[model samples]
Target: MTHDPTDQYLPRGEFSFLSLSIGAMIRVLYYRLRGMRPVRVGHCKQCGACCRNLHLFHRGKWIQTRRQFKRMIAECPEYERFEIMDDPGMLLLFSCRFLSEDNICQDYENRPSACLEYPTLDLHLRSKVLYPNCGYSFKMVKDFGKTMKAVAHIQEQAEDKEDADE
Candidate 1:
């Protein structure tokens, strides 16, 4: 049998330097092609947070607010129900009319692809955007070496400016 190269980096489902390192080019490519994988499975608590603040992909751009989205997709049959609401951040929240009071989706069988990919770590890891009391979580690894180098460069430039001032 041929040796599995990833077996060296990944032992018992654990992964390290899978990305971030040129050494694991194959692993990195594999992950990039497969997209991010969750460490543990997540079950939606039916908080309905995912139902709110819908961002529709219209004309290759994300339209944040519901009113604008409605105007954009007015001709579509599914665009009949929506709510114009205020959210905490710069994004305007739009509640789905199909969602029930207990956070259960009324149209679960016909849910959109965006709904299926809610709370995506890839999308919101840097933004820190997630609903309160979410049961979902994902494991992410940041490149420490690259991050530290950028930090050190910024610090060195700041120090150089300070020394010049003195």
Candidate 2:
């Protein structure tokens, strides 16, 4: 899914960077505090907040919902209705259809790749740019930060390998 810069809620330019940093910090804190807890933090309460709050991006692309999937014959269709919507730098909105009235996925096990990978702290941190009104935003932010650090470490290793090869 692609977001328009003209979107009312979309984040602009340098603000995205600041938002990513803040999200990462929040994610780190959440993990530190949520350790050993049976219940995961920043998770849906089965309230379907994500589904109810769904908004499509500028293009016809949107997140695939269970209902949408049911219309498709195969799990991976030739024309996927949804695309990973990013605003040049960060991911943005991808609404789901399978979301129940209670905000739970009716067919979670068979959900698409996008649904399976939701609330990824890194993606959330990168995309949300500014915190949405969701309760999980803070926790997602923290996770995103930790993930960013890990990604940076990985990138550094890749760069080191290239330098050595040179």
Candidate 3:
């Protein structure tokens, strides 16, 4: 596919609280159906888009750099980058210190908790916090429509239970 340089620094829409809640529901269903699948690794193609465009929230604030990341970690070492919540702890963010002009991680094997959990549907939901420029969110929205529907279904079930109890 042809790369678009403009996409590298574009401001994508913010993820709503509802979207995140639904995404979490979908993630639970995904794990129930499919145990953590071996993530298929792919060469990034060095678009530099991920690094140039990211929305990271660390230590009660949004950040986008190695320095900020270090400081955030220092301030709240217990906080995990959301992306690495799955198996294999790794920070997955749009930008990386090792990222060259070509958009490649200098330290691939020992990257942060976020980098290790790329491409998962849950990760896509949190993309607004990491790589907002990448088209992964759009693709995930399309691919996981059913999962979203299931989330709605689960919500309805919970509401019904509450009403029945009343």
Best by TM-score: 1
What TM-score does prediction 1 earn? 0.49
lDDT winner between candidates 1 and 3? 1
How many clashes in candidate 1?
Answer: 0
TM-score on alpha carbons, each prediction: 0.49, 0.34, 0.35
Query: Which sections of candidate 1 miss by over 4 Å?
Result: 1-41, 65-68, 71-76, 87-90, 141-166
Clashes of 2: 13
Candidate 2, 1-166: lDDT as tens digits: 1222243432211122232355555754555564411111343334455553433321223334544433442545622443333333223344455555655565554554444333434445445432354433332223445567779999999999999999
Worst 10 residues of 1 by lDDT: 1-10
Q: What is the lDDT of residue 137 in candidate 2?
A: 36
Ranked candidates, highest TM-score first: 1, 3, 2
Model 3, backbone clash pairs (residues 3+ apart or across chains), number: 11
Better structure of 2 and 3 per lDDT: 3
35-93 in candidate 3: lDDT tens per residue?
33212222334455644434455443445455676676787553333222122223434
Report the lDDT of model 3 for residue 106: 57
- What would the TM-score be for candidate 3 when compared with the true structure? 0.35
Q: Is candidate 1 or candidate 2 better by lDDT?
A: 1
> How far does residue 132 in candidate 1 sit from its true spot (Å)?
2.3
The per-prediction CA RMSD against the true structure, in angstroms, equals 14.6, 15.2, 13.7
